[model samples]
Target: MRRNDCFFVSTNIFSTGFCSLRKIVRWMLVASMLTSMPVLAGKTLDGIKARGVISCGVSTGLAGFSAMDSKGEWHGLDVDICKALAAATLGDARKVKWVPLGSQQRFPALQSGEIDVLSHNTTWTLSRDASFGIHFTSIVYHDGQGFMVAKKTGISAVHQLSHADICVQSGTTSEKTLNDYFRAQKMKFRPVVFENFEASLKAFFSGRCQAYTTDASSLAAILQRETRNPGDYLVLAEVISKEPMSPAVRRGDDEWFAIVKWVVNALIVAEEEQLTQANLDTQKEHGNAVVQGLLGNADDIGKLLGLDRAWAYRAIQAVGNYGDIFERNLGSGSPLKLSRGANRLWTHGGLIYAPPIR
Candidate 1:
């Protein structure tokens, strides 16, 4: 939990140096498309094949989300997606390079081709969808903005805190959302915004601010990992903003989008079919029409993506199914212990639904 370790990056490496993520994303968007058709014209798949790995940008350190183990192996829901892309492209899941990026630097990294995809827990916004010239694929997680405050403060609801200081990570949707929520409610509060999330969180926890504002899932993870009085903190029930987090790829490349999209969709679809990593081998050979098609025995979808028919199979093998990832990282298997809630598939009464594979 440090400043530079949070989201701070040198401005010299980005467009306009400081205070602008959109500017950097814009400039890189133009560059990524310049020779995209040549190097990746027919080579999107070949480029990744030749490069040997897929480079993806992720958050600095959010436990059970996108963090490194002692051996430097990356494992998490988002991390698995990147590995799956590598498996689909290179036929080897470990053939991936993890580019640790802070919240603001993530999109720019994707546009500049520093990474093939942005896997940070970034919310898909309208402006980001249109102006950034990038496509967000799949809602990997459904979340909402919330506030975290120490229980010792005896403040049970956000409405009870008047004139309380709040800590927030800069360059996140939290900034505008926090301001709008507080101002619209006519509350008085001081904002202690920092360039890095750790700085803000540390400050807030250390009494620099009365509360920390971020996505509810993140606040829960932070509490689960860092708080001694984990029960001492309360996440206010107010859901201020809807955060549909997903991975993003550069625009103007429809095929590339399809490949990434399908790779993601495969995970969700596989979960629906009960095709976990443990059971994929058994069920992949099942005679069900959907199973055969998804496993590449029935169609040419893999050929278009520059992958073998079993690309989806390889993806599920690398990362398991969507439910496996959820249970392992954010659900029953992990420390977070979060309920599926809105992340469940449509058939299960959740909002996340994938397109038909056929």
Candidate 2:
């Protein structure tokens, strides 16, 4: 053999006595890469499958986000997220056990394994994300902290509430943001905090406090559902803090986290593709490659998350896309009648965007 020739292997390993140094190095590198790849154990998913239901934590009672109707059926944007997750994971949207939790109880419930996922409208901040032993999956709603006062209070602007009494729910970012806003303006105010959401709303509506503070979306819901006369209350024009509401899960379960994250992304992607529950079947039949991939007709993306091929299809068939959930729960279809605003898709000049499914 010439000095420049490369060694060829036969069926018998001993036949290739001389091998190229480059080939040996390449094989060693491939082996190292394969060994370093992380294995997904999926313990949380196993538990959920074993129980045949997903335990989802939601707000005690926040209209438009999470609330139970008179019939005892839960409905809201947050509730739909759990439904989508359940549909994707278990092939049934109704296979979720909703656990109503207060602002203070949400984190503890998630940390204690009392809930598989926290679908409550909780804000994502650096401190909580770093210290809470939980991971925020995705920002489902773009919100802001604002004040809601009785129309008769004559408080039209946020700055006008200087030295006023503010009613806020304890153990929430609303309480802290209210203080920061007032202190930043060199003003003083009294915080009348309540441990329960209903109590805080009652305190504000009953004139116990001059202003009610919480997420602006929550304020809208309270005005529409809680108040006897919606016109009697007004949400101020000034928004104080950015509240990016997200779903969270406990740490140490990368597999479960990815499942939750991608389930949400799948909703957004469906909206971007103009796919809805009504047209999903038709689109699956005559749609493009991306749509086919999402519906599991082309690419089997579900297996990457340890799910079956039709995971995304089941989710969309159950709750529709992100836009459908938003409109039905928080937008014109619901009493809130709030515009998409910052929650619209990025293609439509809003902040909502998701990674590609394929």
> Which number leads on lDDT?
2
Candidate 1 residue-wise lDDT, 249-268, digit = tens: 88766777788889999999
lDDT agreement with native, every candidate: 0.83, 0.90
RMSD of 2: 15.4
lDDT of 2 at 133: 84
TM-score of 1: 0.87
lDDT of 2 by residue, 191-298 (tens): 998886778777888899999998999888878878888888889988999999999998888999999999999999999999999999999999999999999999
TM-score of 2: 0.87
Error of 2 at 120 (Å): 0.6
Question: TM-score for every candidate vs. truth?
Answer: 0.87, 0.87
Q: What is the C-alpha RMSD of each candidate to the true structure, in Å?
A: 11.2, 15.4
